[model samples]
Target chain A: MHFGIISTGPISAEFSQAIKFTDGADISAVFSRNAESAQAFIDQQQLQATAFDSVEALCASNDVDAVYIASPNSLHLSHALVAIQAGKHVVIEKPAVWNPAQWDQVWGAAEKHKVLVFEAARHIYEPAQKIVRDYLVGKKPKTVRLNFSQYSSRWDAVEAGEEPNIFSLKTGGGALVDLGVYPIYDAIYWFGEPDGVRYFPALAPTGVDGAGTLVLVYKDFNVIITIAKNAHSDAPSEILLGRETLRLSSVQGIDLVTEYTAGDEQVLFDSKATPGSRPLSELMRFEAEFFCDMIQAHLEGNFDEARVNRYRSLTLLSRSVNEVCTNARYTAGIFFENETLEISG
Target chain B: MHFGIISTGPISAEFSQAIKFTDGADISAVFSRNAESAQAFIDQQQLQATAFDSVEALCASNDVDAVYIASPNSLHLSHALVAIQAGKHVVIEKPAVWNPAQWDQVWGAAEKHKVLVFEAARHIYEPAQKIVRDYLVGKKPKTVRLNFSQYSSRWDAVEAGEEPNIFSLKTGGGALVDLGVYPIYDAIYWFGEPDGVRYFPALAPTGVDGAGTLVLVYKDFNVIITIAKNAHSDAPSEILLGRETLRLSSVQGIDLVTEYTAGDEQVLFDSKATPGSRPLSELMRFEAEFFCDMIQAHLEGNFDEARVNRYRSLTLLSRSVNEVCTNARYTAGIFFENETLEISG
Candidate 1:
């Protein structure tokens, strides 16, 4: 399938490169707010795709089969709606939209147009999920702790008086939406919606979260999601079940998953092919490939049962995550008018 | 200092063993509700002391200079008061009292009688405190996370229909008081008191917190304290100050303290004297010795400055921790009638 890229950000480049590993996906068009940036991105990537000066033109392109929205958080709804209304499948970056209203609107449009809309939360497709599933085959988790914290390189630039977009509350940028969403999505995927949610955010001077810890209370187990942009955590994320534990070295990008039982450590999943092989630098490609397969399966109509299940799961997960984020933000007293949008069926 | 033992439980034996390492402290009396249990304990430890049938009898014994109350949580206030009224200094086991009112009452009695009251929380006297202090010299912490979770050995017995005191809500037996207090004390010692506190507890079938996570919000940083009696956590507790982090391998015992800076780990303090020694079991003796020295200094009127500082610090910590615990319990909606006690000035 041919893919259209939106925005000329670093993530778009990563997505474009990752498309190389997919079975049936290629970048056919690129979109940027300005013509110069679009032309530059095309030239830099050495792609045969046409450069579109506007998202409307990109959505109008007949050469593109699906559009990948990598725009800022604030623009996700607008960009995704345009693509979906144009009868094009859409692959949105993590945090497809800030609030449930936008989520419902986007999905409503996608359903009306009968197009697939995928949230690009790649961790769900990683081998770590399979490892966790296999580990918890018969057992039950008592508690799950997920942490994804790193001192962003952009933080130094922002500290040096540069206004990075990520530090701007106006752009729907905050540690919770930007980084915390990963662990939130992981929890939603693994445990479904929580019974209750609470957030403790360290809001930056820009009125955005610089760091935060979120507790998602489940019936049998509690999930603690810790995320930060101004600091780092070296401790691995963990899932405790009685005396057994499943550990992921990095929650942000899980490269290794280990299980500890009876005081013995066993590696369940490793991104590396061999002990001495070059580390997997293009891990994001796994999600891209998975999305491509999902899109292909959905379009071909060969596996209706599997396709329906995937759609239902994805829709439920997206709605649950968006709702949890909304509740947490409100509870923390960091009110965003749009973020207060209630979940709608 | 000759000590009178209150209650002949497992902790009493542990305390008796630990008292052997103290400079001038000895178990001079053993107290139990029944004379048979007290005599058995005395015989087992081979103590050259009397076995009193009642706390009142032990308190009246001139051979005892201080009383170490190792009774159940419900009886700490009354036991300590008896010792205080008898002109004996007191060392009460942790969760010294469930509520601030009980704490104030015990301290008021001790003050009125001109006797010292100590809460025997062993972690405070460990080398971990000095290591953290040295590491954070002139620096402010951005965030601190402390976890102390262990699968209780008594869980099986409790599940088998045994009403172990640690699992009884009527006796103020719960993870928050039994195990959570360790990390709470750590937070109070390191950060003084937080501006706000919240707890999310997973209550057991007995109506006590089986496991829980507490968030203490300070002005510049927040502390996350996780404690469990139903499971275990292998993640090292961390104190983050900018890019530097001080890690404790075990928050409850802190066998090793490591500092990480710029991607390097340095072992700041290790309980092991040699590289491969047996690792200093019965480390609880250090706290007992510290208490013995404090009691000796206070009684002899020596080391006035050090004694005063230590006393003042311990009092402040105990009060702050009790206050935080009260607020957290209320916020979590686990209302205990005793937990609603106001902090006395």
Candidate 2:
């Protein structure tokens, strides 16, 4: 399989590397809004791929089989739509869109084009998260608490008066949209849509959430989502099952995951590999693998429950998070940079 | 000091044992509405304190210096008011009252009678809690997550057709009112009243909350509260500060509080004691000792800032929790057994 990369940002560069390193896929070409950024990608890495100034030219290149939309959050929907319209498979970063309506449009385009559309939510592919799901198989789970809070350096930039894209509402920035969505996916992927939802968010000066908490109430269990960007936490990026708890010490990578039972029992399932790989690249690799497997299943005329589940789950998960952030902003009386004007959007 | 037992229930029995085992206070008498219940307490304990048929007689007794109100949740207010009016200090178990208005009345009465009113929130008095708070003094605190969920046998009975008084809405029974208040207290005590609050409660068939989640937002921090009475979890009761995190394996007792810090640091603050002393009872002892110290300060006509801080903090904490629960019940259409009855004395 051949993959084209978009944006040439740091994330895109890493994803390009992961594709180059992976067994099944080759980095075919790289595109950037600026020719200089694309040329820099080639010069720095000494890559064989063609550098294109526009996405359309890159999509037209016969060498590319799929396009990876590694652009800013705000551009996910439009970029993916363009790629899907060009009859190419698409893998976009998490938070498929800024809001649900955009996601609906993207989904419609994907269905119309008959091409794979994947949201890169890496934890779903993590072995430890699967362990958490498997642990809940027999027991009648009654409650869940999922926490993934990593204080970002970009938040410090936002605090220092520079408005990074991650802190701008226009770019789908906020702790909820960026960080809390991880736990949201965990909850929905594991437990399905909650009967009800409630959210509380702490906003940056730009009105984007610096931190937030969301509670999803299901019929038999309640899941809590805690996320933050402004401050540090030692929260086990974990899923708390009723009988046993499956936990990861860090969201960046799983060094250790432990399971515990009622009588102070312990089961240590630690992945002893050193943290040498780039986390973002690992996530991109996992996304590509899932996409390849999913597309293969689709080609075989098989309805893969896991693949379809991922699609529907990410759709609803992103939608639900957007609603929570909107509710939080309304309750907090927050106004974003884009709120003051339509800005031809 | 002489202590009069307020109820003959199992909790009251435990209270009597705790007081007996406690260092400073002595059980002078036991009070119950029924003669059989009072006699059972006498038979079981082999105590010299005579049984009283009513709370009024116990309060009026010259031998009783303080009253421990361990009655049904609904009866806390009436019993507390009576004991305070009788010039005896009062130690009321949690859910202190149905509402803050009742709390206000009790506080007013206690002030007029020159007696102290204390809620037996033993977690506040625990050594582990103290250690955590002391550690946060110089550190720039950021986030806190408190979870105290345990499946109760009483709730199982409540769910199975019986409207146990503990599950009775009129009696202040529910997840938010019963178990959720602890996390709320922990948050407000540690961080202070939130700038905003959001609650998501899981309402049971009886209209009582089986479980709930609350997110308290401070200016630059967040506190996530997850609690339940109809579930089980091994998720450590956790507090996330900026510099480090203090995690307890069990929220119910003080054992080993593991502190994990930045740069791969780990410190164990173990207060493991011998078999003669239990963590929960040790908290009760601390509460008693604190009360003794407060009384001494009162006799000296000196206002103790620490005691005043605790009272003010608790009052604010309970008020904030009550506000959120009341709003949530209205929004969720939660019904208690006596919910239809006008909430009045």
State each model's TM-score restricted to chain B: 0.92, 0.86
Model 2 ranges with Cα > 4 A deviation: A20-24, A33-47, A127-140, A219-221, A237-259, A264-280, A294-345, B17-24, B33-48, B137-141, B238-260, B264-269, B273-279, B295-340
* Residue-by-residue lDDT tens digits, candidate 1, A1-345: 889999999889878878877777888999998888998998898878999988998999899889999998789999999999898999999889887778899998998999988888877777667777666767767778787777777766665876577877667777888888888988887777899898988877667777888999988668888887877677888888766778887765676788885458888888774321323326677788777887887667654787789777888887888889877876787754344444322
Expressed as tens digits, the lDDT of each residue in B237-332 for candidate 2 is 666653356676555455667777554556455666631146444457666666656654554567578778876776566666566656556555
- The sequence of per-residue lDDT tens digits that candidate 2 reaches over residues A224-337 is 777777655665654545445556665545566676555565655556665324466765566567766666566566847877887666556656655554554545554444
Model 1 reproduced share of reference interface contacts: 0.24
- Models 1 onward score TM values of 0.93, 0.85
> Chain B in candidate 1 has what TM-score?
0.92
DockQ (model 1, Cα): 0.48
TM-score of chain B of 2: 0.86
Candidate 2, residue A72: how far the Cα is off, in Å? 2.4
**lDDT by candidate, in order shown:** 0.80, 0.70
In terms of DockQ, which candidate is strongest?
1
